[model samples]
Target: MEDLMQKATEATDDLYRIRDTYFPKDVNHKINTLQTHSQIALNILDSIPLEERKLATQRATYEYLRGKILDVFEEYSKKAEDHLSKAVKLNPSLADAWLCLGNCIWKKGDLPATRNCFTLALSKGPNKRILSQLSMLERRMAQGAENQEEIVAESIKHAKEAIALDVKDGNSWYNLGNACLTCFFVTGAWDHSKLQQSLKAYQNAEKDEGMKMNPDLYFNCATVNTYLENYERALSGFEAAALIDPCLNATEEVKKMINLVDKLDGLLKGQIKAKRLASLTSSLTEVQVKPSYKRATIDNLLDGLNKAIAVVGKVLFFIKHENITPLYYLVCDSNQICFVLTVYGMSNEAIKEGDQVTLLDPCFRNNNFSWNEKHYELRSIRVDFLEQVQVNGKPIPPRHSVRSSIYAQHKP
Candidate 1:
């Protein structure tokens, strides 16, 4: 009986070691063998008479290990959760059991329950990996919350703490990088230094032995590159990740990115005369904050002239002519309202369709609505900065173009 208990304990420990450092054909085989031994140990113990099998701390450990193995399959997730929760109830001090339970509940889409499980694990002990996991959970929750900035700040705090505790922990570094990227997304700000920090953190994580097999790490790096407008690097990292694991949950997301990059790359190629800006801005600082433009609809622009208000919309198409220095765009808002929007002194900036922007101090010129009238225009429009002409799409350099050979007219 004692020999059987020892065998079970050894199997559990070996299983964890194999699980942590997943590599080599032998490690996978060893994990499977240990998982089978763990199940058999439980079965033999259960088969014994109630009084004969003197199960103590081993009971909780056995249940936890069995649950951990079962959690790998989606169909058995509920059963795994039950076993893990039971194990934690029997021995609340088992950090591994608590963490496993958290993972199980998270997969089941119980964010509150998952948070509780991780909190319980932290109560039991301080672990950098657990802290990093908790940070990721917090970030996920923040994305869905109304107070996004506040929650993101908390997420960053937790990730920073994990890194401070163990800079060598690759998971911590990965979580920190993700938290920084999340901040950038939420704020929609260039945040040059913060993005650089995220890239550095990702590089450090890649160097760590534990992060070698994680495709998501490379995926995150690719996403950051996209935000930085480094499309070539982004494509390379994304392709590398897809080759490593083509069946990830994020595979569709990667495909979308690939399509966007391809489209943007083709558009950029057509701009043969375009000159790349040295940075996100031409000569001014990168400004990502909300401009002074008030959120007004196309209906606002079509209404009577209001010099006090500003309107914003995305470009749909351009009407370029040899007679005109700047291009005219047919812009529309989410309200399904459309208008003719244009800019002066922006011919060199190369504003294109599919750009979302806000206009400041715009005054509508016409309110007449007739079948022949196609759009409305803004007279003497004021542009805050030339760089503000750029939008969130694939960032392209400004270019000047003209159908100088053709003397013709086209409706905007």
Candidate 2:
């Protein structure tokens, strides 16, 4: 009986190991291995003496191990739930069984019940793993709540608490980074400081060797870099994630970014819009910058603030994008150099193609990179408010400048 119990423990440990570390191209292999180990563990437990199994502690262990193996598959198994419930009833102090029960209930979409189980597990003791799971649960809950910001703040707090318990735990740092990234998007996706904090946490997570196995860390880190306009890092990070987990759409993201850059290059190189560009530039008149605002061009502009500067450009193409913030346009300056101009908090009717526009206090970036044997470069300038732009040499009317919509389209 002792030997059989030892074998059962070993099989259960194997299930946990595989559940934690296995990420395979073919999920069937993983599933098969888990099923095999689960059967072995169950058989060993069943072979134990009936007298020994009658003991409360022994019965709880048996039920918990069986339930956990089913839960390890991440599918909602009725048998798993029944066994876990029995285990917790047999021994109320079984924190791990409660954790397994919580996970099982989560799959059934009983989020509040799942939370109850997690809280019960935590009440038994402070477990870093349970705290991290609760943090994730908070973020998921925020998705539907009207007060999303408040809930995400709670998520960040729990993630921080987990890290405080085990500072060296890579998974906790990764969870913290995810929580911060969630905060960034939930609060309007305009906070650069939140993005920076997320990136820093992901960087710290990378210092731990175990985190390298988590493809989401790479994918999410790349997403933050993409928003920050660190294009090269974003590309590499996505590529790394794709290599690790082929199921992710990281490769598609790479292709989409490359395609956008290619389209920008085509529009800027005097291809489809050359005639319009020439005609617009011919009628362009000199516009004076305010004394406080200096004059600068795209090539000389730097990342971040090009503060107190004016850049004059003619709208050449209305850039199209899916529902995302900050409308985009391909524009050409008096020097005939083309760059993307992004406008936020302005209505679509506020500006039109061929309008001679002045950008005040512009934010800028010059992105250059090589991917998949192709080189790409793009220059961008951003105007955050209608007040920063003058159309056809005059400020826009307050009525037309109201932020009524946030979508982009292209029309000649």
Candidate 3:
């Protein structure tokens, strides 16, 4: 028994030297030496009677040994939780032990439980590093909640606090970017001002090399570009992100947009052709003629012109049903017998020969022309009647002056 006590006292002294070397600053040679001493100390403790052991001395010694043992096996690929739990049992007030417990829980994917453990560690000692990590878990949990607005607001608040605590924290910037994006998603409005703020936050995160490895940052940049209508830039961003994570939805969305743009290009080309044809037809009937005939003959020609203008106007109205403006010019032939309608924009159908037509004062009000300087030309035409006329290969009528017969007839 005397010999055993001597060996145990030597082992305790070795354990103290090892503990001093292992903590605050680790040295490999000292750590290896410490591990050997720790095994011996455990053996000695096992042999000594619990009641006989000096309680204060034994507690201090056990606390030191527990910390050193945990450090030695910190990153071992085994049941780390079991080892950490044992250290906590030995010294419940060990703040570092609680931090290690939180990390193990995070690794096991119990995020909520891990968050609770981290909170406890922070309560014990408000370590900035642990608090930052806890904020990250909270941000993620908020993202998965149904009330996204409230979640994002809370997440932004936490991220700001984390940044205040550690301005250089890349994770805090990342969380801020996520919170801004979540705000955009919940609102469904791409407010450029808000998005610009989000872009700045993302830029800060991108400065950290490790952040580039995360596909989420790239995907988010692509989403912002898409909102800005920078299609080419958005496509390139999504492509790079897809290379990192092929299963990302951004890859498919970019592909779909590419196809949509192609279809729109084709449709736009067809519309251009239709617009050109309508303009050319309107320009062909510029000359108007007035046949010097009897009052009855003049009446018949005026009636025909009115009827033809009305019919053509109806056709023009249908052609431009979806257009913003409905104004058009009519060119009558020199003989005052034939006319062509001109529209401002593209029309699906070209003006063809054999179509019936009509004419009306462009600014006619209540069946009477209004002499407004802005629309003087459109108000000049007096006839407002429909005519059944055939389009044929014939030169347009010569330009001749025609009096407003409708006005003369209406004069009281």
Which candidate number has the best TM-score? 2
Better of 1 and 3 by TM-score: 1
Q: Considering TM-score, which of the candidate structures 2 and 3 is the better prediction for this target?
A: 2
Tell me the alpha-carbon RMSD of every candidate.
15.9, 4.7, 24.3
Residue range 1-412, candidate 1, lDDT tens digits: 4565466556555555444434334445655665675576456445544453335566676678668766753333778898898899888899989998998889868899899999989998788878888988887786546776677778888888888898888888888888887765554333545667788889889989878777778888877765554545666677767666655434565565455433332332343221332221232222232454445555655433354454555565564433232335655544544555545434434666656655555545432221123222222232323444445433334443221111112100
Model 1 weakest lDDT span, ten residues long:
403-412
Which runs of model 1 end up more than 4 angstroms from their true locations? 1-55, 249-412
Residue 71: error of model 2 in Å?
1.2
lDDT of 2 by residue, 287-383 (tens): 7767898887777777878788888888977887543555679988876678888765566677899788999888897777776787777788867
- Which regions of candidate 3 are displaced past 4 Å? 1-112, 124-132, 143-147, 188-192, 244-253, 263-412
Better of 1 and 3 by lDDT: 1
Ranking by lDDT: 2, 1, 3
* Model 3 quality (TM-score): 0.42
| Root-mean-square deviation of Cα positions for candidate 1 versus the true structure, in angstroms | 15.9
Alpha-carbon RMSD, candidate 2? 4.7
lDDT score for candidate 1 against the true structure: 0.60
Across 1-412, the per-residue lDDT of candidate 3 in tens digits comes to: 3354456657765675444323222345555776677677668655766665455444434444343344443354235566566556666666666766776666656777777777777777656566556655665565445664565566567667767776766666776776665555444332345466666777787788656656677777776665444456667778877766665666686766465334322232334344444554453343232233111111133421232232222122222222122122233322232222422212223233333233332212111211112111111222211112112322223221121211111100
User: Between which residue pairs do clashes occur in model 2?
Assistant: none
Runs with alpha carbons beyond 4 Å of true place in candidate 2 = 1-10, 270-278, 281-291, 321-327, 342-352, 355-357, 382-412
